[model samples]
Target: MTDRAKGWLVDLRPDERWDDEACCGDLPAEETRMADRLCDSASAATYIRARSVIRRGLAGLLGEPPAEIRLASEVGGRPVLPDHPDWYVSWSRSKSLLLLAARYGEPVGVDLEVIRPISPAAGVLRTVYPRTAELGAVDQSETFFTAWTLLEAAVKATGRGLARGARDVWLYRPSGESRCALGGIRNAGEVPWSGRTEQFAVPGSSTRVMTAVVTKGFTDPIHVDAWQLPDRPPSPVTAAAPRRLLRKEVSA
Candidate 1:
């Protein structure tokens, strides 16, 4: 939760058409094949852009060339740097936004979702809503997304993903504040680990995008750096650089 974490938020809206060659030229061969298989141009472009952002961001953090950052996946399909096992990362993409979070040795998970009307379906309510039993009194849409993203972030942090079930994770909001915390993570009806959860709204956007980050264990105040991409390049992150430039701390 402390200022120890770093992240980047990139705009995924296509401002200019990038052909397959332009988009996949610098990607790894596997990624290029995956991109090539996508029939939708926008989806392919978004995939390429997200992978590029991850490479560049990790490269900046590791002080290496983007192409040289080798990435692998954990058991649950979470991406990891095989050489730097201590470095934890998570990625999420909404309609036109991609988010990345990284921290050394600490598990981190981030999720972004564009807010829209929630169907009053029983299945959705059961899967997304916390078991607090007070949901009937609040704004259903806001509460639904708040709970949804928090559970997602927490589950992702655990690396078990939805396989662990969102209902097993609870997000607790201390009345009358924008802040919240991971109440507990229950596996097989037993609490295992606690976490810190923070939510933010992307600035200057017409559509409402709700994002949340869950860091395992308790920590200091969480600082989120929301970067609008293609417009803002990744800040040069070097050990010798000024701390401010390394990770521009922003209040989200």
Candidate 2:
């Protein structure tokens, strides 16, 4: 499936148990070391599985074996290819879903989230964001997820982790456009990102899971090409109706 982007390739898979023997061998020593550092066995396993999926997905694009794809990280931890500097990758997880996105020549960051009702105390982060403030208390989950995804994609694209980015990044609508976008990144480093955030949906579950991405090189009409992956039944993610889209503008 695709949206307005020329194409940001994404794979949405369940963060479930995997064949450790089969996939784990494909991961690098770096990932193994990172996994060893984690105290929670479940969290460590998830990290390993996420990396393995990333390796296979990225290796397909590079026409190499998954085990041969060497990975590195930026100063703030977004994964990258040392040999292929032009390629970029980022991922996010929401409940059972894992979102993996890859882009060539342009830096990209992505986020996925499960929609859930918000409470006042749980929404303290919402108060910092001007966009979420526009949403009513009774009906803000969808819009809140959209706003948060935009904020995260911007920070991830900028190579700054949320610890720092959350304090600085501001979600904004570019004047006349109805869709929310990312702005207010001061330390974007060497890459000058357009900071335009785009949202997509995975239809299933009691509610719905949403994903968004942003390309860091300041491009227009950013687009997404996504796959639901295996292990789940896919359904329609209609963006043509605003009322159905959290009154959010769908960028086709």
Best by lDDT: 1
Error of 1 at 166 (Å): 2.7
**Which residue segments of model 1 deviate by more than 4 Å?**
1-4, 16-26, 121-123, 128-139, 165-167, 176-180, 187-205, 219-222, 230-252
Model 1 has an lDDT value of: 0.62
Off by over 4 Å in 2: 1-20, 30-45, 121-123, 126-139, 167-170, 173-179, 183-204, 217-252
Candidate 1 lDDT, 1-252, residue by residue in tens: 223557777676555433323334335666666766666655666677787777766665676555556888778877788888877888898876887888776678888878787675334756555464544433354666666777778778878777456766766666874444467776633324554433456556667677777776555323556654322234332212122211221111
Query: In terms of TM-score, how similar is model 2 to the real structure?
Result: 0.64
Global lDDT of each model? 0.62, 0.58
lDDT, residue 207, model 1: 71
For candidate 1, the 10 contiguous residues with the lowest summed lDDT are 243-252
TM-score of each: 0.74, 0.64
Mind giving the per-residue lDDT tens digits that candidate 2 earns over 63-161? 656656778778888888898787777777775457777777677778877666666622654555543554344245545566677777777876877
